[model samples]
Target: MAASFTTSWRCAFLALLALFVSGAYGQLSPTFYASTCPNLTTIVRDAMVTALNPAVGGERRMGASLLRLHFHDCFVEGCDGSVLLDNVPANGSTPAFFGEKNAFGNINSVRGFEVIDTIKAAVEQACPGVVSCADILTLAARDGTFLLGGPTWAVPLGRRDSTTASMDLANRDLPPPFANLVTNPPDGSDLIARFQRKGLSATEMTVLSGAHTIGSAQCQNYRLRLYNENRIDFQFAQGLKANCPQNGPAGDTFLAPLDSTGSTFDNKYYTDLTGLRGLLHSDQVLYPQNNQTQAKIVLKYKGDNTAFFADFAAAMIKMGNLSPLTGTAGQIRTNCRLVNPA
Candidate 1:
C-alpha cells in the first residue's frame, strides 16, 4: 500500500510539472500593453533623435538617421506599409548619390530600446506610473515596421516593467546582423543554439529576417558569405572582394550594404534571395531547398509580404519572452544605459 501511494504522488507531481511548462511556454499575454501609452510616433522619433545626438559621421547610422529610414519606409501610404516607399542607400552622401548608413542594421536599434526607456521615463515623470514598458517596445517596433513596408498588426498594451536591466538578456535577445551560415544553420536550433540554446524552427528564422527588410546589413557583418563562400556561394565573390576586401574593414568601420534595398521593409529581400543575390550566404541558403525549414519560409515571403509582418511581430513577442526578469528579480532602471543606483 505504501508503494502504491508513492506511485500516485509521483504521477500527481508530474502532472503539475506539465501544467507549469505549458503555461510558461505559452505566456502570450496579448492583453499586455501600457495603461497610459504616450504618443508613439512623436515620442519614439524624439527619443531616436536624442540617442543619435552624440553620433557624428560613423555613428550617425546608430540614432536619428536610422529612425528616419524606418519612418520613411513605414509612412509610404499613411504608414500602412506601402512598398512604394523610397529606399535609402546606406552610403547616402550629403550630395547627389547615396543614403547614409543604409546598412546600419540593429546595432542602433537595440540602442533605440535603451533610448525608449529614457523617453518612457520622461513620460512617466510627467504623467507618473501610468505606462507599460512593453508598450514602448511594441509601439516602436510597430512604427519601425510601418516605416519598413510592414503592416501594423494589433499590439495590445498593459505590460509592466521589471525592476532591472540585464546586459546578457539584451545581448542574447538580439540576433547578429550576419550569422555565419556555415557555423550556424538556419534551423529551428539556430536562435536557440547561439544565445539561449533554445532551438527555433526554420519558420522562426525566416520571419525574424523579415525584420531585416527594414534594417541595414554591413559588408563587415556579411562579407564572408559573399567573398569567402566558394563552397556554398558561387557568384558575387570576386566583385564582393573588390569592395569588401577583408573579413572586417581595414581602417574605416563603416561599409556598404548587403542587400541593395535594406532600408525599406518590403518583400524585396525575399525576392533578392531567390535570384541568388542574398547578401549573406546564410540568407541564400533559405532558397537552395537545402534547409527544409528555411526553404518554406522563403517561399512564403516570396509569395506574400503581409504574412511576413504578422509573423515578425509574433516572433518578436516570443523572442522578448526569453529569460525575462520577473517577481522582484529586476529593477526598473531609471537610466537605461546604466544599472539603477538604488
Candidate 2:
C-alpha cells in the first residue's frame, strides 16, 4: 500500500510540472529571464542612453525611431524580430526573398538598426545565446520611450526570434501617414480599421498615435497636406511649405517635426490634433469634428498628462502582447539580422 501511494503522488507531481512548462512556453512573464539574464534590462537601457547621446553623433530623435521599430515589428508577424532580417539571395534550395527594410512604409523611414545591433552585441557578451532578439527589441522600445520622457512599463519577455520576414506583410500591415485622406473631411475609420485588424481597440489606436509627439515627418509625406489641405493651420502649412517644395522630389527628404516639441514624448500631439495642426492627415483625422467618440478621448488625453501616460503605458503593454512567438515555436538568432544556419 505504501509503495502504491508513493507512485501515485509522483505521477501527480510530474503531471503538474508538465502543465507548468507548457503554460510557460505559450504565455509571457515579466520575470521570464530573472535567472538566465538578470541584467538584461540594464544592458538595453545603457545602450539606448549611449545611442541617444549627441556627443557621439547619436540623436535624441533615435528614441522615436527605436519605438517605431518595435511597433512596426510587432504589427507585422507578431513581434518576432523579422524586421531586422536583411534581404536573402536565392540559393539552390532557398528562394530569393526581400525584407521589410525596403517596404513602402519602411524604406526611407523606420531606422535605428545600428542601435539595436549594438544592444544585441552587448546582450550577447553577457548572456550569449540565452536571450532572444525579439525580446531585446521590445525592451529597447520600452527603455527608449522612458528615456525620452515617456511612461515606462514592465515588459513581459520570453519571445523568440523569427526565422523569416515578410516585406509583403510589412507593406500591408503598417499604417500609412497619408491614410484616410480621400473623404471630403478625413475620418479615423481607415486608421481605426487598420489597428482593429491588429487586435488593438480604437481607443488603444488613438493613444498609440501619441507616439508621433516625437520624431519628424519627411516632406514627401506631408507635402500634399501642406499644398492642398484646408484643415491645416495656415501658419503651420506655410512653415512646412518653406522646406517642402510645391513640386518634384527636390525637398522630398526634408524633415519637419511631427509636433512643436518633437524631441520630447508628451501629450502635445493631442493638442496639435485639437487645433488642426496635426502633421499627418491620419493624425488630424483622429479628432475630426464628426468623430465625437475619438475627439472626446483625444481631449481627455490632452487635458490629463498623467492619465495619458497611464493609458499609453497600458496600451503599449497590450500592443507588445500581440501575437508573440513564445516558447519553442522559434529559435533565438545569434545575429538579429540573419537566421542561424540550418
Candidate 3:
C-alpha cells in the first residue's frame, strides 16, 4: 500500500509539471507567422513609420500610446484583444457603448486605435484570414518602441481576439493612477499587488513604469498631485498649478509631459523621482522618502539604463503572454474595432 501511494504521488507531480511547461510555451512562438505571413514585420514597420512621422506633432506620441494600450489590454483580460472591441447593440434592444475605453484608467486617455487599424488593413491585404489583431498589437507595440529608440524583443505571436468584452472587468482590474496615493501613499506593497494579480513581479512593475518617460498626462489626472501633495518639487508643482486650477477650466484638457524628457524613452523618469519630481502620486510612491524595497530597485535602474531596457523587454514579453487565446480558440477579427460576427 505504501509503494502504491508513493507512485501515485509521483504521477500527480509529473502531470502538474507537464501542464506548467505546456502552458508557458505551447501557444506562443516568435515565428508563428513564418509561413502564413512572411511580410508581417515589414508591413507593421511601414505603417508605424507612416503613422509616427515626426512632421506630424501628435502622431509622434503614438509609440507610448501603443504601449499603454497593450498594458491596459493585458491587465484587464489577459491581452486577448478584448480591449479593442467596440460595444454594439447586445440584442437590438440595448444601446451601443464602449468597453474598456470607458474604464477609469482608459477613458479619454487611450489612443492609437487608428495606428492599429492601419497595420491590420495592411496585414489583411497581404494575407487575409490569417493574422490576428491581437498579434498585430503585440508586434506593433514592440516595433513602435524600437522605432522611437527604445528596447526591442521577440514578441511571440499566434494570439487571437475575443468576441466578447467586459467594461466591468476593465474598470475593476486596470490600476488607477491614484492607487496607493491618497493620504500617505502605501508602500509599494499595494501597487505590487495590482501588478502581481496580472502575473507581473514587483521588479517588472518598476521597470515597466519607466515607460512614463515618454508620454504626457492631462491636467485632470495629476491636478490633485500638484495642489494637494507636498512632496513634489516646489517650482514644478507651481508650474503645474498654473495650468491646472483647483476648479475645472475649459483648458483643463491641456497636457503636461509625465517626465521632463517626454519625447525620449530613457532613465530620466527614475532620475526625476530621486529629485522628488515625480508627476503622479503613484509615480512618487515608487521611491518614497523612507527606504522601501521597491525604492532600492528603482535606484538600481536610475543608475543603469541598459538593465532597465533589458528587464522591460522581458517583462513586456511576459505581459503579452498572459492567457492568450491561441491554437483553435478565438478568431482573427478582420476589424479590430468590432467583433467578427458569427
Q: Which candidate achieves the best TM-score against the true structure?
A: 2
What TM-score would each prediction reach against the true structure? 0.60, 0.90, 0.88
- Give me the displacement of residue 324 in model 2, in angstroms: 0.7
> lDDT for each of the candidates?
0.47, 0.85, 0.81
Candidate 3 has its poorest 10 consecutive residues by lDDT at 181-190
lDDT of 3 by residue, 1-342 (tens): 996886565445444543443358676777778899999988998888887786754376888899889888888778788888775656687667668877878878898988898889899999998998888988888887887788776677878888777888887777777766223455433677778778778788889899898888888878888878888899888888877888886447889898988877889899998888888878888887666777888899999887777777777777888888987888989999987877
Give the Cα-based TM-score of candidate 3 against the true structure: 0.88
Considering lDDT, which of the candidate structures 1 and 3 is the better prediction for this target?
Answer: 3
User: What lDDT does candidate 3 reach at residue 214?
Assistant: 83
Q: Write the per-residue lDDT of candidate 2 for residues 55-127, one digit (tens) a residue.
A: 9888999999989999999989788999998888999997988998878889978898888899999999999
Off by over 4 Å in 3: 1-23, 56-58, 90-98, 181-189
Candidate order (lDDT): 2, 3, 1
Q: What is the alpha-carbon lDDT of model 3 when measured against the actual structure?
A: 0.81
Highest-scoring model, lDDT:
2
Model 2 poorest ten-residue lDDT run: 13-22
